[model samples]
Target: MKKIEVFVEKANDGTYWGSTQNLPGGVSSYGNSFDELKQNLKAAFKDYLEVGRKLNENWVQEIEQLTEFEYQLDIASFFKLLPIKISAIAEKTGINPSLMRQYASGKANVSEKRAREIEKAIHELGEDLLSVSF
Candidate 1:
């Protein structure tokens, strides 16, 4: 068995969403509460594992490798903290505020570029705060 870390976040619309950091399409259900979201994610992971097992191909190993990647990054806590506001993130990343809000609220799909921008912004913020504290 492989271990994968799941991160959950509460969207602005009062729903919860979660994903595994290393799995490209490993995102799970969006629900009105954390427990509901977790339950849905459990079901999703079970189905994913079962499908991989049924396929009887190298896909199961691939998924295990992906989970390993996630473990290396220690991204399980990525969604645990909401450090930056959508407006601030938009201002920093030059992304539209509405789009940022939509992405943060889980109302819209995050484009690759947008996701990169968000990641960059978060990284910069983390570095800055660390520098200030140190």
Candidate 2:
């Protein structure tokens, strides 16, 4: 099965929007929440791929094999789904608690570099946890 990466973000209007990175042009979809967004995105992908296959029948196998999709959530939405406290994560990531809260609340934007740093810290913590034999 082929994997397509989808990036999801929460819009200011309190709606979730998503788009695929590998697909050509600018195809997008929107919904009220993450679960809704997933359903809508799948429908959008089907519609988008159908248009392409209509022009070229060679894309049949590709469309059929395209069963897996991976979603990357934006910082605010990620924090919304995360079960940890901002203060706890701030300590783990070495980020300021207030700043982390602001980012989590969508009151402040987290830069790509800072977001990477935070994610890296979380991954490293996961690796450490995995190393515990007990």
Candidate 3:
């Protein structure tokens, strides 16, 4: 059960694009939305695997056996894909709302420390939501 990490980005035309980070020749795809992008990326990769299989590429065959994909995207890409409000998340994470907005828009670089803070806050929020009975 191998997972290929797909790096995703939001294009200028509001399209989402993604590519495998560990695959050669760059298995990639684009879509109007995130779900569509993931679907297309897998379909494209399967086709590529079939072609590779015919060529007897051992590496491709190994990956083809059970290669799953997981998307890794930046903050800007997350905002583009989800309805999450930046200011709200920022307040919960103790980040300045304006600074968080800049991060979400790719206008600012988030340090590793800040990234971890945001990730931790999101996970905690998810857990809190999961505990709701109503």
For all candidates in order, the CA lDDT equals 0.64, 0.80, 0.86
Candidate 2: where is the Cα deviation over 4 Å? 57-64, 81-83, 106-111, 122-134
Model 3 alpha-carbon miss at residue 17, Å: 0.4
User: Which residue runs does candidate 3 get wrong by more than 4 Å?
Assistant: 131-134
Per-model TM-score versus the true fold: 0.45, 0.71, 0.88
Clashes of 2: 0
Prediction 1 TM-score vs. true: 0.45
- Model 2, 14-71: lDDT tens digits are 7888888876654689898888988988898888878777877665566557788888
**In terms of TM-score, which candidate is strongest?**
3
Q: Please report, as a residue range, the 10-residue window in candidate 2 with the lowest summed lDDT.
A: 56-65
Deviation from native of the Cα of residue 123 in model 1, angstroms: 0.6
